[model samples]
Target: MIKPVKGFSRLSKKEKIEWLAGTYLKDQPDDVETLKQYWNEDTRLQQLHDEFTENTLSNFYLPFGLAPNFRINDRLFAVPMTIEESSVIAAASKAAKFWLDRGGFKATVINTVKKGQVHFTYKGDKKKLQNYFDKIKPVLLESVKPITANMEKRGGGVLSIDLRDKTDELENYYQLHCRFDTKDSMGANFINSCLEKFADVFEAEAQRYEEFTAEEANLEIIMSILSNYVPECLVRAEVSCPVSELSEDTEMSGEEFAEKFLQAIKIAEIEPYRAVTHNKGIMNGIDAVVLATGNDFRAVEAGIHAYASKDGKYSSLTHASIENGEFKFWLEIPLALGTVGGLTSLHPLVKLALDILQKPSAIELMKIVAVAGLAQNFAAVRSLITTGIQQGHMKMHLMNILNQHKATKEEKAKIVDFFQHNTVTHSSVVEQLEKMRKG
Candidate 1:
């Protein structure tokens, strides 16, 4: 049996990999070489990657691709995406090219407010707590001025602070709910720093208040952190054209395709089972761009899903309708993105991705990200309504299947050509490969 490791983090990168390989990959001795193969040849660049997180073993890579012909707000762009999935980039690209002729996508930033909270417990009189909050609110704002000064100068800073009582939900529970505008950066650290300061000052003031008893004055701070559910930091992206224009290449009439597409969206909106997968398809596009830009895709995912269920039911993020001979599709999602901080400045590829996007502001990034999602959904639904999803998805996945079988160059060409006129399935590809090898 393998024993637990101690001081694993203190181990050098080489030693850490040796220990991991010996402890877990003993049967596959060649795995050590496999890990080393992925390391950057340049020592300086490899060291930069190692410092990004703890227990640096080796780099795990995902393909960084570009989907071209995305015309958002009348500006053309070749949006960058980083993901491992096969068909996502293809779907997004196809949708972008299709819409490019129909005036492309229109996007808008609805708002950019973020939130944080300081939770504490105090068995104090409600009226006294409210009065104390009102009195100290100004002082609380004043205390964080040094931290917010730079953000303020950039036209972003603390927006407001309010005291919330949760005594009925949990005894002795209260919180300081705060809002902020961090401008170009995601501002997680900035918001969290300001929140911790607020907590310190709030606790200090409670102790000195004359109205509070000793127990009430001793407010216990649970935590101070920024919230990932930023419902107010939202953006909207949309595309619309006459129903007649939607049938450019499809076999169905534009009106028929529009009706079918609307019904598919209606199913997603009303059925939780379909909505989960439907929204996942949208995120396939959203997350690829979010990761490429080096912003927090996980945070964006959490906030967007919460927003989807804001009305108390998980539903579709993208909406579609056929309105008076016009076919419209759009999505409004909460995205707390940054163009100036975290990995955006540090990661080389992230910087490249930003440049590819024309170095947009935070709001601009939100709109672009939202449009990517809407475009992805449009492509997916279009496929589902006409040719069915698997015809395109399986075709895109054919290359991955070929690689897995370790087909040679000549064999890959033959197999790819064959699949163009034939169905693509794992068993069928293996059977075809086996036949080709035997001959």
Candidate 2:
């Protein structure tokens, strides 16, 4: 067992990962050996270690940190984030703190159910299908009942089912949409499992006609389906900061800054380049927190990106403005995360992070994550409006660079000071550290 730090009663997952990774880097052991030492399952960790060593190891090691002092819907908490991009942590923390200086933040999330789509292609007679609605619809919907019993027990089940036809795009093809209430789980696996039953139901109903051959009729079911970003069953967060706290650091009036921020929002709506990076800033904090908590970051990323272009045009995910002379921020994302399954159960460090959170349900986890997304967005927009993103991130990057060079703490400070003064170069950092070492 590893020893705990003196002051840290509850280290977040990012912290735990850092502690283990830093130890591994210091010891510089074989990858497999490193995996075996900290991770529970040697076999599983070894595979991950190999994959990480060969590919995307650089992507994996981005500096992960936590934004502290967040009060979401009157609950005090900290948000775990992993990012290499500069100023995100500082910006998020400052935005959160700004709200706290008022009455603290009040963030509320809906029931947190995610919709799973089941797509299929049927190039049968769309004209004849107009005469076949009742028979096919009831049977198809009924077939999913048994599969949804467990979900019903947990107070969630099949909420609704929808169907659409697209003959203009693809000839003689239609789409079947299955909208299920996943309860507290991401429900991708569960939803796909029920698709076969639904397909069987449809096939049996259609087989009544001699011409309706599922095989010969060219029928295919596309599982791992897509989700629509509907306003109903949406996750929304509203953060308000009081004008009193705006005076703490006043190069410009809070009202003046708010107007400038509002103008930037209008600009981002029209500019694709700014919107892309702007949304990325929101994800930087969000993806880290999700990954740290053992949620599927890929699905979340896909959903958010898809939601960005919902208007048939690209736009920023976040909207900020100075409302009534106080900063008001709003964000919406379909974060389909589950608290009690998969990696949360298998991973050692994930369990440790959950224990620190001490939330009772999956909905609670969603609330925190949504709030983190908002905090991250707030931090980013504030940075862009103020001193730019680089000034804050460069310091942290220097610390990492210093650590990589094995510079002593004093040497790190000296080199970092030199770095702040001018552009930092690896050779220059090494030479400076060497001179500091000798001196």
Candidate 3:
């Protein structure tokens, strides 16, 4: 029988990931050739190569487990996240437990709507093109009726359609914006379909020379693409944890703890090097989920990094504190992902992960991922403040170092002891371990 996570005291460092993943895949097929084949499907190998060559890979896999005790918006969920940094899963789990003692994370999503742009360049006179959309707004909306019917039946659909005149020095183009509900998916394909459906109408309306005569408006449909994904829609989560839960022996004050915590983070905010790693920790959580769900990590990565340096230079990705002596954390990042079709369906294991989630739509998954990111950020900042960052992390590293050379348990223990006692001299430690094994 699967055991319930009690707390930090009961956790075993060696089996952390296996425990956290729970019924999730334990031993992913270790056959390198087979694994390489799996990874190569859908040009993933090329992308990974590009990423690796860019020197952007920071091996961020740690066995940090966030214990369950959360109920978000009256629903129970077991959130599993993979990240390599100490304290993130622990801190988030701690904060979540505090909230569980009260109510849970009260959250709501605005709408799962996204915008796609269709750019049309024409000599139909920029002013005339503008008037065309203005005149056909009702017709376009009417045409969207059939497209949106299914979404409407499911309680979502087209909220509005907009057009704007963007004139380049060389030529003029009209951008048509279609805002529609993606239902439970990312809605990219659906949005693209809607735009294609309007192609005939758009061409007829912007008709230039029929067979090379009468009119002279050279209409060209350059690109029908999605917008930059402005998050006009949102999923907001507010968890009110009782202050009583976080206190220790002398009845530690949550407000005071939070204030001190904020002060430490303020230091990271002021320093660039610290900010880079600090922000990387936040992405640790976000990217892990993006990877696990087979979602586009690149889009989320671009959006977040861009958001961090929005004012110019990059900075932290989360804001956390205590309100009324209760911990409160908020994180915002551009999360453009789909739970339906495409990669989500293409991979077999991906489907299994989603099945474990038992979530109905992409929005629910996004909320869970957002929570993980906040949890991870909290874990990172808290560790930096309370203990020196290297302490917990180095201990884990010791295991990896000892695992090198296929060291036996006793050899591993000896090496760790020597390292901890400051007697480690790389060549000496390895020679000693080998000598002991030979004897």
On TM-score, the candidate that comes out on top is 1
Clashing pairs in 2: 73-107, 91-379
Q: What digit string (tens of lDDT, one per residue) describes model 2 on residues 174-256? A: 66666766777767677766766776666556657555546534466654353634333457776767543454554767666
RMSD of each: 0.8, 9.1, 12.5
The TM-score values for the models, in the order shown, are 0.99, 0.79, 0.70
Best by the lDDT measure: 1
Per-residue lDDT of candidate 3, residues 1-439 (tens digit): 6556666344443244344444443455343233334343455644543344232212233342434665777776666555554445555676566566567666666545567877876665555666666776777667767777776787666677788667664476667777876766666666777777665566665554233223434466787877545465455555445555544422346555566667766765677787788878777766766666767777677766766787677776666566665666666665666788766776555666677677448788877777666656766665666655665556555555556678878778777776675534446556877787788
Measured with C-alpha atoms, the lDDT of residue 231 in candidate 2 is 32
Model 3, position 359, has a per-residue lDDT of 45
- Supply candidate 3's per-residue lDDT for 207: 54
Question: Residue pairs in steric clash, candidate 1?
Answer: none
Native-structure RMSD, model 1? 0.8
TM-score of 3: 0.70
Ranking by TM-score: 1, 2, 3
